[model samples]
Every structure is written in C-alpha cells, then in structure tokens.
Target: MRNYFIFVIVVFVSLSSSAQHTIKNTINNVELITVKDSKFFKGDKPYYFIGANYWYGPLIGAKNGGDRARLLKELDLMKAQGIDNLRILVGAEGDGGDSRVHPALQYEQGKYNNELLDGLDFLMAEMRKRNMYAVLYLNNNWIWSGGMSQYLEWNGYGTVPNPFLPDYSWDDYLNYTKQFHSCIPCKEAFYKHVKFIMERTNAYTNIKYINDNAIMSWQVANEPRVLISPDHETAFADWLNKTVDLIESLDSVHLISTGAEGKASYLQDIAMYQRLHSNKNIDYLTMHMWPKNWGWYSINNEKTSTITSIQNANAYLDEHILVAQKMKKPIVMSEFGFPREKESLNPTSSITNRDNFYKAVIDRITQSKVEKGVLAGLNFWGFAGFAKTNSENGKWLHGDDFTADPPQEPQGLNSVFASDITTLKLIKDANLLLIE
Candidate 1:
C-alpha cells in the first residue's frame, strides 16, 4: 500500500498546484510587423468583431444583475443576428495597476474588489463556451471616493474634467500615484500590480474563446496622459515598450491592441503619445469619437450632418487605418458611439439620426479593402441591463430622451433606446449594444 500512498500524495499536490497558473505555450519567435492584406492571415475565415463596450464590474460595483449568465444569454441572442465580440475593462484600478499584488487575486481589498476579476474570469470563460471573444479594457475615466482617485477613467476625457480630487498637475499626479496605496500604471504601483496580473492572465486557462486568438486584442491604456512629458515620442514609446514587455514576458502568444479614441492623444497625431505607444507592439487599432465633443479642443464640428460629424470621425478612422496598415496592424472600431442630439460634448444624436450614423460608419468600414483588412472586428459603446446602475446616465449619454435640455441641460441631451438602435443591426444582433 506504500505505492498507493505515493500515488495519492502526487494526485493531491497536482490538483492544488493547478489553481495557480503558468504559461504553457509561447511564441518561439516574436516579430513587430505592420499588417498587410489582413485577409492574408485568415484565408476565407471572414474574421469579424461586432459587439459593445460595457461597464467593468470592479469599478461599477456590480453585485449580480446580468453578470456572466446574463451576458452569456445576451450573446446567445445576438448570435442569431451576427454580432460576436464584447469589450470589458480589466483595468489599472485598485491593486491591478500596482506593482505589489493584484487585488484581483487578493481577497482583502473590498468585497467588490476580487469581484472584478471573478467577473472577468466568468465572462471570458462564458465567451469561450459560446465561441465569443472580448476586448479587455486596461484603464478608465472615473474619479474616486470623495474624489480621492478614479477607478474607471476613460481616454483623455477624464483629465480634462480634472476628475480626481485636488486636480493634480501631471507631475504631481505621477508623484502622488507612485506613493498611492493602489496600483497606478506607470507609477511604482504599476510594476507590481499590473505585471503580476499580466503574468497570471498569460497562464493557461481553459478560456479558449480568448486564447484561441478568437478574441480581439488587449487595449494597453484608455484615453490616457495625452501629452506624455519629456518627449511624446520617447514617453509613449517607452510606455508601450515597458507595458507590453511585461505582458509578453509572461503571456507572449497573444495579439495586442489599443482601444484609443482616435484623438491626437489616443489614435491620431502620430507625433503624440498613442502613435508612440502603438508603433512598437500594438497588433490592432480601435477608436472612439464624438466630433461634437471636439469643441473642447477647438475643433468645432457643427452637428449638421450632411452627416459631417460621423464623416469626420470616419476621416479620422481612415487616417488610423492607414497608420495601422502602414504598421501592418489591423483596426477595430472598438468604441464608437454618437449621440442623437448633438451637445457641446458627449453629444448624443437622436435615436433616428444615430442609426443613420451607425449605418454609414459600418458601410464605410466594411466596403474598403485597405481598411477592411486591418479590421478584424468592431464593438460599439455599451451593453444594456446595467443602465439602472446609474439612473444618472442610465443607458445613454444624454439620459433616456433627446430633448436638448440644452440652453440648460447639464445632462446635455437624451435619446430613446429602442427607436435609435432599431436601424443599427448591431443592436439587434446584440441587444446589449443599446444600453445607456
């Protein structure tokens, strides 16, 4: 029975070790290539990405209400319509962005803390079960408690509002972040928090939906530090190099990309940070827009569409596609949502008008060869059912109606969900698309 005892011991040890992950397969060689003839890689496969950008549970504090089971059911509903991928944020928050330990794996941060990663694991696993893919957001735009810090901050948008408490100078922000208890990317916390999680995510998981290369790609940071100091080129390039280096050091076999909003800081303005970061290792490209929102930057986009706003966005899209094509990286319109009623910012087009915009954008993207090749997918902003999470802006940028409370609409404008999304097939394919 001594032999039987040895066998039992080995079995127990194996089962316990399985809980911790380690990379099983990695690329033998790596290359920095500018994608050409994206179709060249996937013969007649017609790889496509059609989905939505939804809130991340960690920051949103989602206890249940449509967590994974709900998301999976939605995906099933969409499959009948042809939409396939979903974008979820697995960002630089709490301990994830820190350099010490990922609060995702740690249970002590907050009840809502570990809940974030658990949600992701479930979502990713469900995606695999359903043969769907997800784009994981790595940063956010929300400010924190008593304005202490922001959990979910978006592209360059958050900084403009100076969301965080004590609106910090870029320098002060950096200094404060390094010493802050949470994980903040590029801060001392980043190395420990983000790096640790990156390593873990790279490890073998049965979530083949993402790992099968079926998933879209990883977005390094949201619209972030627009003008990287020192030098945009050096700063962004260094940032990209370090972030991806750490990610690949552990999980090297997957494709990487960014969900930047196509702004000078996010996607365009090659001399700016986005290009700097993207040029090095980004495998695909994605963007977000609100030409109406351009006023803040002094780029006034009159909402008179002979459909000009979406057109301008598409123009920017073209620029990005060319850039990605030049770099051999494909493109994904990962986050593009226009409002029905045009406001000064976060303009929401009318439900009817917005549908027109979606159609135009989709047609333009799908019809071009150079642009199409680079496009492995597209996911619109938001999924539904969580709109109640915040009656504040539930389901739409302008609230639920399109009356420009303007002249006096702090909540600028509102749009109807059903009618607006009716014309956009993406919504039908995936009902989650129209969520506020």
Candidate 2:
C-alpha cells in the first residue's frame, strides 16, 4: 500500500513538471531580432534582405469583407519571391472619410473597431507562420490616414485641413499638422493608443505583442516630418523622444525606429536628422526617396531623367549612409518608388525604367553586404500582390481593392503587382545574394 501511494505521487509530480516545462518552452521559442555592432541578426545569422510596404495587410486580414484567400495567396507568392520582411501599419485612426482608409481600426478617440483589431492579430499570426518579420508603424504623418491630424481634430483643434481637398492648400495642411507636436491633449491621447496597442495580446496566437517574434520593430510613424520651419524642430524632437521612451518602456525585446525620411523630413537639413536620431533609444535609421516627388525625375523626360534619378538617389543614399556610420547604426532606405513607363497607372505598362531604378537600389545593399557596410536593408515603396486596380483612371473608391498606394495616391502609380515578373526576379536574386 505504501509503495503504491509513493508511485502515484511520483507520477503526479512528474506530470506537473512536464507541463511547466512545455509552457516555458512555448514562451521562449521565438528568437527576437537583435542588433549588435551596427547590424541586424536573427539567431546568430546576419539578417539583410529586400522587404516591402504592405501597409493594408491588417485590413485585408479582417473577417468582414477581408479576403483571406487573397491574403494567403499573396503571402505565399511574396515568400516564394524571397521577400520576407514586411513594413505594415498597425492600424489607422479616425472616421473613414474621403481619401481615407475605410473601416478604420480606431474610429474615435479611445474607441476601436474590434474587427480591424482582429485583422491585425490575424495578420501577425499569419506572418509568424511564414517565418516573416514586420516593421509596424504606429501612426502616419499624412492626413490620408487621419493620423496626427485626426488626433488634433479629436482634441477640438478644428477640422483637419486636408491637403487633398480643394478647400485647403499644402501650406494650410502643413501648418495645421505641425501643431500636433505642441498639442498637449493630442499627445496624451496618442500615448494612450501606444500603450493600448503594446499591451494587447494577439487574439489569434494568444501571444502577447511584446513576446511576438513576427514584429521586427515598432516604428514611430510613417514619414514623420518637421514640416515647413526649423522652429518646429524642438517640439518634434521632444515628441519623438517621449514616444520612443514609451515604446522602450513597454517592450524591451523589439527594436524601435522613427520612420523618418532622412533630411527630407528635417527641412532638408541632414544635421537635424542626425541630431534627432542621436536619441539612444532609437535602434536604427530609416530614409525614403521619391524621385518624382523631389523633382529628380520627370515622366516626360524619362530617358535622361531616369539616369539622373539614379545618380541623385545614390548621392542621397550616400549622404545618409555617412550619418548611419557616424551613429554606428544600420540604415534602411525604407521607402523608394518609380512610376511605370510614362508614369502610367496600368499594370501592363512597361516597367523597364522602374526595374532599372530598383536594380540600382538593390545593388547598393548587396554591395554593402559584401563590404559589411551599414546600408543593411531596403523595402521598396510597396508590394501590391494580386490587387486589381483601375488601370484607366487609378482613382480609389471606397470598395475598390487596396493597393500599395494610399487612397489619396493613384492606385497603381508606384505599386509592384505580382505580374511584374522581372521586378520579382530582381528582388529574388538580390535576396539570394544577401543571404549568401
């Protein structure tokens, strides 16, 4: 009888110990991305590759009107093409309006659309399954997404001066958006959003966000700019630092970035770029390039202008690369795009010039990888996957399929469709070189 009781107790103890062991293993299974000596690493291997801006991923992953089939197909196709890193938007804010993302994640201050939140969970879960990483930006500087401006609007700062609307000019929008830096209530409300997102557990996988390996970094905002005057620099820097500090306090495992557009976000002052990013909490540097937007390329003068665009882009990249070297941080050209032949919105339009431009950009990273330089990665403007666009007018209506371009931009203007075989091949080949 005594031996029998002892045996039963031993068995029970062994089972309890096994259960605890399994739980611990599950919690620590993923190796989060880390940085050391100015480079990114994943489980002891150097990490460098081509990624894409798939900002609308979460929206499409939703159960309501969210096309799971298309999302799965796109993920598989991108994975097959060796594009594993994705820069995604965590969610959008404010009521869905003209030229704004519909079914927004946050429709009001402190209120959320649970469906969109579920979509975000689903997207993160799927990315984890594919062994892909995401750089999730928390907000946007632009009004197209109802970002900072929306927060200001919610705080009784008057209606957002949307630059896309005829009633407002670009200056009108810039001046209004710039006030976000100094608005106390707006800043506080945004911090609440930050905390809420950071603390939420993923509904699909049941893993807390801080422990999820699918997230490579938490970006502050998309193209967060100083806007118009150097006078706004002080306020902008303070806001940026506080945001980074909040993120760091919440999650010590993942990386943090400002999502800055290099000097372009700093009143064209590289020194200001360096000074702001000098924050010790910021893990890496990011820059964006738009040849057409910056006047380095012209659709009417494609032949000569394309060459000039490449040269100017290289110079711009080099200038920022120096800053990264000085700061001893890895730099990523997180956004860059070229239009199709003749700046056409048609998916069937020639991508010869676009491909050429992409190749030049990819080559820089590959060469840097060979030299073990700090130009660690590049994610082109976007990957549209299998999205069908309005090839004729490119205008985005409410129910239209989401593309890489925002609602305010022409749908196919800078989107890389799945049919862009040559561009995919370039990305694939470049990724191969990166891994080698």
Choose the strongest candidate by TM-score.
2
Global Cα RMSD, each model = 9.3, 1.4
Q: Tell me the number of clashing residue pairs for each predicted model.
A: 45, 0
The deviation in Å at residue 205 for candidate 1 is: 6.6
TM values, all candidates: 0.64, 0.97
Compared with the true structure, what per-residue lDDT tens digits does model 2 show for residues 282-343? 99999999999999889889989999999999999999999999999999999999999988
Q: For residues 2-103, what per-residue lDDT tens digits would candidate 1 score against the true structure?
A: 999999999888876764433332221111122335532332334544565553423233234224444554556545445556666565333323121133
Q: What shift in Å separates residue 114 of candidate 2 from its native position after superposition?
A: 0.6
Question: Clash pairs of candidate 2?
Answer: none
Q: How many angstroms is residue 57 displaced in model 1 relative to the true structure, after the best TM-score fit?
A: 5.9
Q: What TM-score does model 1 achieve against the real structure?
A: 0.64
